[model samples]
Target: MSTETPAVRVTDLTVAYGELPVLWDIDMDVPAGKLMAIMGPNGAGKTTLIKAILGLVPPAAGRVEIHGGLYRDQRHLVGYVPQRGSVDWDFPTTVLDVVMMGRYGALGWFKRPGKRERDQALTALDKVGMADFRARQISQLSGGQQQRVFLARALVQDAQVYFMDEPFQGVDARTELAIVDLLKELRTLGRTVIVVHHDLQTVRDYFDWITLLNVRRIAGGPVDEVFTSENLKLAYGGRVEFLQRQAPCDPPPDAPDLGSYPGRIRP
Candidate 1:
């Protein structure tokens, strides 16, 4: 939104859990107003990258910069929507209570949210079409509804860069479309949105830039240039092959002879 440099920059980034390296030598730059998608197989460190950028997790190597500065210096300009599975939805909290939490970071430590914060939270809920469900308990909402509620929580931050981790996971078609449209609108408004996505089928339609990770940097750039089948094979680690072979229109070649392997016994 602001006439500034890139919203995120990671150079020679490396992260490790104890001695095991998760991300290696990652270098990326995300400009403002771009909808960037990150895709990789499970355990490829997609969420780690997001968490490291948010300063929630420490990276053993490299730097994360936001708006040409360290992320901490620009924390107010960055918002994060973690996976729905990350939180305990059953916690006794109302939807409005969750959305209001976004304002806490801005209000500084020890500061309570006031009427202005409540109004902003409500507006954010409305933005995600969850205003009517404000008073409802988070656990009472559907999975899609909960996802939108989390998104509204992030929206209340009013950040310039939003990092969403699998915002579409388990969501129905309508909810998926609504969230997708909301992300598109964010990009149009000049905010940078980076999403960790799992659905490979809609990559082209949802994102302009794609970053493929596989315990290492596989490829990253415009989707048209980097999202090739070869690159996907490298990113998915043969799992994509299994999915392709199992498609409804194209059954496995040896379906009738499932026990053909030397060690496999036919019943």
Candidate 2:
């Protein structure tokens, strides 16, 4: 085990909506400077887990700690990119205006952002390749552009830990590659990134650490150690067959063709 402190820790975490439990007892530790993916099938509480960690949803039990302290006490250290579907794209707001919201926490009550915040937001937009669209209305951007703007918002926070929810959901292939490269850059800068990802084929290619979640955490460790056929079977059950097609193994003589599994697990 690594002796270095974890960037994010969830212990005995449980969350429920009224009487229906969404997430069961869960414990996970994400190490610093690593790109981690939280993956599971639909209705597996992947989003709920992110919400709990960010304090957007109240956990019915357990606690979350950031660098060994409560999240509320270290809010400034964290940045969040919610699923794009959660926002109203038609809202009358400019791309730069949305990015500047990342600085609201630092601005505090009644204090408006000035030149410093604008400069920071612009730098963040440039990092995501969206600086040229700063004056454009958010509604005018494509799905991929919108995602990049959200990334810029998180970047402007200058946070040590970032939580992104399904950033590649509706993006083009080029956008996906760009986002992957940005994630790698963040890791290189010693920042920890946790993403809610749905694509199993890209898991091995994109992330070093992974947590297989299904209401509860099935496995959490280095991808090579935990992202095995057996662990995947435990998490996805019958759906494991779809993932087997992408596994790094020679096909058996009787194995079905990869093209047959057209359905993908979306969560």
Candidate 2's displacement at residue 6, Å, is 0.7
**Error of model 1, residue 29, in angstroms:** 1.1
Give me the runs in candidate 1 sitting further than 4 Å from their true place: 1-4, 239-267
TM match of model 1 to true structure:
0.87
Report each candidate's C-alpha RMSD, comma-separated, in the order given.
6.0, 3.0
Q: Give lDDT tens digits, candidate 1, residues 88-110.
A: 99999999999999999999999
Q: Please give the range of 10 consecutive residues that has the lowest summed lDDT in model 1.
A: 258-267
Tens digits of per-residue lDDT, candidate 2, 1-267, equal 468789999999999999999999999999999899999878889999999999999999999999878999989989999999999999999999999999999888999999999999999999889999999999999999999999999998889999999999889889999999999999999999999998776788899999999898999999989988788877876646544455534434454553222234321
For model 2, the superposed segments whose C-alpha errors exceed 4 Å read 242-267
User: Which pairs clash inside model 1?
Assistant: none
